[model samples]
Structures are given as C-alpha cells and as structure tokens.
Target: MTTESLAEPTMRVRPGWTVAVVLANVGVFAAWFGPIQVLLAKQSEALAPDNKEFVFGLVTGIGAAVSVVAAPIWGAVSDRTTSRFGRRMPWTLGGALGAAAGLLVLSGAQGVALMLVGWCLVQLFGNAVLAAQTATVPDRVPVEQRGVVGGWVAVAQVPGALVGTALATVFGGIAVGYIACAIFVVLSVLPYVARAQDARLVVAPAFVLRDFLRGFWISPRRYPDFGWAWLTRFLFNVGNSIGLLYLFYYLQDEVGVPDAGTSVLVLTAIYSVCTLVTAIAFGAWSDRLGRRKIFVVASGLVMAVAAVVLAFWPTWPGAVLGAIVLGIGFGVYLSVDFALITEVLPNAVDRAKDLGVINIANSLPQVIAPVIAAPIVKHLGGYPVLYLLSAVITALAGVLVGKVRSVK
Candidate 1:
C-alpha cells in the first residue's frame, strides 16, 4: 500500500486538543519522572542503600510488566468502542482517574509490597490513556500534519519533566508531591476529553476471542516494514532507558553528587532545552523533506555516540555532555518515529490494535531494561559497563532501521 493511496484523515485534530494532549503527556512525565523518582530514591535509601539498583529495578520492572499487558488490551477495546463521546474519550477519562488513584496509593506506600502494587496500578491505567491518546494521532490527524503533531508531543516531555520536578520540590514531601501530580494529570486531560470531539464509529467488527488473540502476532514476513519499525523502536528505547532510568542512583553513587536530585534537574534542564529545540526543528524538517528512515538512523547513531561519551568519562561534566547528545537524538527520534509508524500500519481499520502491538515495543523495554541492567549493575562493577552496553544496543537499532523499506 502506497502512502498516497491510504485513506485521507477523516478529520483534522485541532490545535486545542493537540495542546491538551501534549500537556497530558507532560503530566505523565511529571508523575513518572519527578515525584516517582524521588519517592523511589527515598525508599531505596531507607530500605537498602547497598542494593539501590536492585530495588529500583524491581519497582520499574513490576510497572512495566503490568503495562505490557494492559496497553494492548486497552488499545483493542478502544478500537471496537462505539460510544457517543467517541472511542478514545471513555478510556482517556478512565485512565486518568485510575492513574490518579494509583498515585494516591503510592503517596502513602510504606513497604516494597505496597510500592509494587501502587506502581503496577499506575502502569496499567496510565497505559490506557497512553494507548487511546496515541491512537488519536493516526485517528484524526492528516498524514501531512503528523510530523508537526508528533513534534509537539515529543517536545512536551522536557517541559513536563521540569513541571514534575518543580512540583516535587515545592511540595517537599512524597505524598504531597504525588497529590500535586495527580491533580495536574487530571487537569491536563480534562480540556481534551471535555471539549475536543472524537468521531463516533457507526460500526466496528465484533470482538472475537480467537481474532483478538491472533491480532497480537502480525507476521513479520507479511508486514516487513512494520516489523522492522517495531524492532528499531524496541531496541532504541531499551538503550535509552538503560541510560535514563538509573540516573538518580547513578549521580548519587558514580558521580558522588551530594544532592543527586537537584543535579538531575540541572542536567535534565539542559537535555530538555536541547530536545525541545531539536524536536521542533527535526520534526518540521522531516515534514518538509518527506523522509523518515534517514532521521531515525541518524538519531540512533547520535545516541550511541552519547552513550560512548558517558561510558568513557563517568563525571558530572561527561553526563551533561552526554545528556545534550542523547537529547538531540531522542528528540529527533520521538518527533518522526510515530509519523513513520502511522504510514506503515498494515490495516487501517485496525490501526489502534496494530499500534497497540507497536506500543509494546515501548512498554516492553521498561521491563526488559531493568531485568537486563539489574544483573549488570549488581554483579558486573557499575554503570560503565551498562553505558557501553547501551551504546551497542542503540547502534544496533540504527542498523535495523536501515532494513526498513517503507516510509522513506
């Protein structure tokens, strides 16, 4: 199927909805990175400072495990939904509320068991919102606008991190910080759910148990482009998560920063600025030039190089430089990657389901990264080996993107 022959988008997603969705993404990041990060750190410090990596790994792994299952289920349901408020709205609202409830539980969590339950709830419901909201891109936006729309979503991450950090800092307590993030998440999602319109489907295929099960396995031989895209995203995200998710502990242990939390904000500030600038530029550039693979390959290579820098020089200065490079690479990848995915989907009628399968590549890595890194960080010295491993994984992602024949 050629890009030109694919159905034109039935509606153009408005700027208001786009902005609201972006803010919602920001809220998620704020919750995930800011308050959650601090909370976990405190827990790890209090419970097992010697095994900080292991504790953190376990927490993240639990959440990702839940997300892997929940995301696709929610996506498939959204596809078959025939509601008056539209397919995505109900799930969006439910996801936000569910996530908020989980956040409340996390705010008061006292033990590892409670922490595990709380984060699992967060991941399950948070992914519901993510799956539905992500579908909105291909659902409403025209092919021509996807790059810009993806860019806006991509650029929101940095600001969202900043907002999360500010909330955590201002609240000065994990419980209060979580409450603040929950409120922000609900508020961010409200405008889009309340005001933005989604088209009601007149009819959809009836859900079949066997068909639904089969949908999970899209043959790589039949849809090679989609297969390649999924592989590239999975590998790149795994590499990125290894470098990203352990930063709090990394700064505290490896760099010897007295206040790793504050230092993280500083480095993130640099990374965010670079991501915002580069995302907007590269997003627009991809739209104008009408190319995807080259940008993806370039981003992967850049990230690999950044990982190398961190591996060689394990210092604050090295981290800052690495953050800048990683930001550029990730920013560009985030902008164009979704646009590319939309173009390669095998069945337009099942776009949400297919994208759900693709989304696994994202959520799966959260599980895989911690599982892989925990052993490495625990047994094989420290982060240096991990960073070198990150470089190798990301460079492999670049090479795989070159295998894709569609979307370029």
Candidate 2:
C-alpha cells in the first residue's frame, strides 16, 4: 500500500511498443504450441499410438502443474520488486533466458525423465515471463485501449501458432525446431525491454513476507466480480485446452491423415485467418459499444458449437470447420475477457499479483484439462466424446460469465 505500488499508465501506446508486444507474445506462444507440445505429441506417437493421448496428458499435465504455482509467485515477486531496471523487465529477461535454457535441454533429452525435467523448467520459466509480460497491459494501457490491445495480443498468437507450426514443418528435426523457438523468444522480447518505460517503485516501509502472503488471498466474498470472472476464465480455458492439446494426434488417429503435419498447418492457417479477423473487429467493436460480458458469453457459446461440430463430423472437413469456428470464438473471447478481468481486479497496488492470481485460472485449466481429458479419452468413446465434453463445459462457461456484475 505504499506509493511505490502504483504504475503510471502510458498516455498512448506507441505502434512500435504494440508491435514489440505482439512479436514477443507470438514468439512465446510459438515456443509453446510450435515446439514443446508438438514435440511431446511426436514422442508420444513414437512410444505408442494407442497411448498417445495418455502420454501427452501425463507430460503436459505435469508441466502445467508447475505453471499453476510459478505464474502467481512470479507475479507477486514482480509486484514487490523495486529494481531500477524496473519490476517486470528483470523477470522478463530472466524468464526468457531460463526458458531458452530449458528448451535447449529438451532438444538434447534422450529419456522420458530428462524430457520431463526440461519441460517442467520450460513451464516454470515460461510462465514467469508470461505473468510479467501480461501484467504490463494493465500497467501501461488505458481502459479504452485495453480491448484493442487485447485483440493485438490475441492476433499475435494466431500467427504465432501458424509460424511456429510452419517452423516445425520446415525444420523437420526436433532439436532444430527447439533452437529456432528459443531464438525467436529472445529476439522478439528485446525491443520492449530496451525501449519501454516502467515506473520505478519506491518502498516506504520495506517489503514484508506476511503482507505478501495476505495479498494472495483475495476474498471471493469481497470481490464477487473478480471471483466470477476467475471462475468463467477457468472453465473456458479448460474447455479450450481439451480441444487443442490432443489435436495433432486427433488428426493422425481420428481423421486418419497419413502425415498430420501438413494438415495441422492447413488447419492452423484457417484458424489464423478467422482469429485475426474476429480479434481485431470484435475487439474494436466491443470497445466502441462499451460492452464486454455479452461478447464473452457469445464467444463461449460459439466455441461450444464448434466443439459439437468436431464431435459429430470427425473428418478433415469437420476439423477445418471446427478450427475456423473455434478461432472466431477464441479471438473475441481473448480480446475482451482480459479487459474485463482488469476491470474487476480488487486492488490496484497488487495488479501484477492479482492478474497472476487470475492467471492461475488460465494455468490451472491447462493442468486440469489434460488430466480430465486423459481419463475421458481413454475410457469413453475417444476424441469424439472428449469434444462433446468440451461443448458442454464451454456452454456452461458462457453462463458463468453472465454472473459477473461489474464491467458490462
């Protein structure tokens, strides 16, 4: 609660700054879906086609568990940091470097234990960078611009996925792809770190351990809007992860694509276009209309329908259509939902810490979704039933978002 806690919002977000953020986000996500997840899927396939989903779930689920703890802890540390180099930048630099090291380790890993160790490091350091970077949005951007900024973040992710997949395709070697991802992350993040300004925090009474612990516990009863938003985010992210985490294998196993790589790229291309358009358009429109909840609700419903399509069709065409629909819904939701979360944050002084707490909603789902889906995909009717479950959960997320009283 010192004067040190407040960040001076930027007067206007420069185009260059926006582009840096976009590229950084792209590189980060590319590292994720591009190399890490794809590598896991390939390894699982190598081990056993029948056990691919289970193996992937086990690896990714374990890694994501680290993120559930790492993200918030990183954010809390950033919130208290009084570094002249600025609070977020130090973490940003350290995280990117740490994650890159982890990726290198992963590239050379010869055994499951080594791979697990590397991936866990990647999740830990990667989420540290992510928590700090995302906190900058609320720290810098004005309310009116947040939706558009969120759109840019979402749009960056679309190409990040496409480009990451493209890199993997072109490299065709696991080590090469991992190296490329590492390079992209470091290069993409530098411009922002060097050029952007972060408010220097001045501590009055020195940091306290007790205060830090207390900060983590934001009472749901006191901040119902934040609670509701968090719940909605958790549900929606879980739904989304279940659909995506097994997509590579789904193409190979379910749709029977001989070489799933080209098909995945094609599907990602379609998804990219749909996502880019909806993120920009819907994001700006929501800003103009002064509405967020409706867009969020609609997005969840759209995702539900898309999941239903995949469940029923289970073909290349159905997968393509589902990707397109999922992209559209995901785009709009990504654009507006973060803005809503920032609006509902219970405290300004702990913005990064609080956002990190909200980020748990995101990270926890990544862990939970795979764990949940592994069982369902194994015991139930395979990928189709998984998609159906996604549909049900996603639709329920829409209803959950409607319960938030603040930030209409």
Candidate 3:
C-alpha cells in the first residue's frame, strides 16, 4: 500500500511486524553498544594504555559527531525516495550492510586513525538504519497503540547491549568480537527488511535547495511542543551519557573491580531485566491511561535517584542497585517519551526527518559527554561529582517535561 493510504496511521500493526522491528533494533543496538561497552575500551587500552580514556572519548565523540550529520540527511533522502521496494526499505538494508562493512574495517584496524575511520563509517550508516526504523512507528502504528509498541522497541536496547557485551566478552579478541557483532547486525536486520510494508513515495517531492535547508530549521515558535520535547530528551540523554561513558574506568579505578568487563556484563544483565519489565508494563499502562507526561516525569526523577546512589555509595553493590534503578527509570522514559515525541512531530510528511532531528538530541550528548566527563573525572571531585551532575541534569529534564503541552 502507498503512503497516501497511511496518512493517519489508524490501523494497528500486527505482532509479527512488531517482532521484526524489535529484532532489527536489537541487532543495530548490539553492533553499536558492543563496541561502546567493551571492544573500544580494550582496543584503546592496547593502543595507548596510559591515555586510553582520552583515546576512547576521542573515537566515540568523533563517531557520534558523524551520526549527528548522517541521520537527518539520510532521513531526508529516504523521505524523498521513490524506490520500487519502498522509501525506508532501501535505506534500511543499505545502512545495515554499510555498518557491517564498517565493523569489518574496525576488526582489522591497527592504528588510531584506522580505528577512527572505521567507527565514523559505522555511525554514518548505523544512523540510517536507526532513522528509518524510528520513523516506522509513526508511519504504521496507531496512536493508541504506540506506547506499547514503543515500549517493546525501547526494550530492545538493553538486550542488544547485553548480547553485544556477551559476544565481545566470549569472543575474547577485538577482531573476533567485532566480526561477531557485524554478523549479528546483518542477520538481525534481514527479517525486518524482508517483511516490511513500507510506504512507497510514488513521486519524489520537488527538490529546492533553499526550501530543503529551511526544512531543517524547525521553529520553536511555531512548534513549542516539539521544541520542549527535544530539549527534555537532550537533557536526559546528556545525563545518561555522562553517567555511562566512563563506566569501564569507574569500575576499575573507583570500585576496584578485578575483572571490569565481566562486571559490566553482570550490571548490564541486571539493568536489562529491570528495563524489560518496566518498559513494557509502563508503556502499556501509559497507553491504557492515555497519559505520557506523568510517566516521563516520574522516570526521570527515578533515574536521578539512581545516579545519586552511585555518586555517594561507590561500591559494587551501589553499582548494582544503581543499574536496577536506572534501568527501570530508563525503560519507562524511553518508551513513553518516544510515544510523546511522535505525538509532537511538527509534520507528518517529514516524520523520518523530524525524528532524525530529534535524534540529534541522542547523539549530540555523546559528543558533549566526553568533553564534560573527562574534565570532571580528571580534575573535579571525581566520579562523585560526575554522578551528582548527572542527577541535577536528569532531574531538570523531568521538570522540563511538563512544558511539552501537546501530549499527556
């Protein structure tokens, strides 16, 4: 069916379609987070033991910078696509393949330059897949069901991270771990691409360079809800990124964990289980109650509490408790907030592009987090100060959610 028939997205998506989307996301997140959680740190340490933190931050920050540009451009391109297969399908398939190629490059990298190159490729293409997938929720799912569907999709993140970390840990070497992630990403995305009934753009929109450029600048004055939603998401992610970016080091340096990698896996497992439970349950509850703002506010506050726990306690038990609390908070926030954002999109014609712009909120934090975190860990009151800052930012994100007047 063409997009003209799906202008309002009233039809409820089938369970099979939901499952496919979830699996594809699982793969994408696995490939992305595996390196973030384990492989990259290990590689950086090997390349520059004394300066692993700097190298890790640089590589990830630059990679996130690439994603900042790639997602919206790819989304806009997909918005104008007129492929026989579908608008989103071609890009989704191409992105997964390109990301896999990037992973292959990473698997063989011997120097920092090559490593940087490989990671940038992964981010560039990975965002394409993410952009297309994110848009599909609004394109296909009905409003009433979005919370539950978004919850299911949101829950994929934890499992994906877990799977990736486990693979990286089980595989041992960096090359083997990267290769495993590459294979998993390709395999996971295939089912979605093969089965998806994406909207086909029969006639491409008229391309006006000036108009196209203007489209990117969504005026906050015209769309206050979108602007507020964007800002809140950005703040929450900033807090999250700062909290997580230095976890490997935190475990080793502060907690004094002997085997940091395995500890990360364990914490992730606890976090995953909690997230899986809350994401689906809270999402369904939001849908049932037809309220989005309350859940978002509550979750953000909960996350802030979790960060505070880690800030003060600084023990293995503290990390575990923090993970559980953070997972619950994140699960609820991720699913419900996604539903809220979809409700606030400025225009349906540019769903993918708008989501991509919103995604900048997600990626930009990664870029800035390193800049923010490195100094705090190095100079300030160390991890304690970092966590306190995270708490403050996260709590503010929750307070700001009340400004998104459109959804609730």
**Number of the top lDDT candidate:** 3
lDDT of 3 by residue, 207-295 (tens): 99999988888899999999999999999999999999989899989999998889999999999999998998999999999999999
Q: For residues 304-343, could you state the per-residue lDDT of candidate 1 as single tens digits?
A: 9999998888899998999899889889888888888888
Give lDDT for model 2: 0.82
Candidate 1: lDDT over CA atoms?
A: 0.81
Give all candidate RMSDs, comma-separated.
2.8, 1.8, 1.1
- Tell me each candidate's TM-score: 0.95, 0.95, 0.98
Please list all clashing residue pairs in model 2, or write none if there are none. none
Ranking by lDDT: 3, 2, 1
Q: What is the Å distance of residue 314 in model 1 from its true position?
A: 1.6
| Ordered list by TM-score, greatest first | 3, 2, 1
Q: Local error of candidate 2 at 167, Å?
A: 2.2
Error of 3 at 248 (Å): 0.6
Off by over 4 Å in 2: 1-10, 47-50
- Per-residue lDDT over 1-408 for candidate 2, one digit per residue giving the tens place of the 0 to 100 score: 335337446476888888877777787777777754467677666665767667678778888889888878898888777788777888887888888888888788776777778788888888777877788888878888988986786567678888778777778877787788778778877987887577767662356789777878889999999999999999998898888878887888889998787788889989988988898898899999989999999999999999999999999889999999999998888888888888898766778789889988887888888877777777778888999989989989988898998788
* Per-model CA lDDT versus the true structure: 0.81, 0.82, 0.91
Give the range of the ten consecutive residues with the poorest summed lDDT in model 1: 1-10
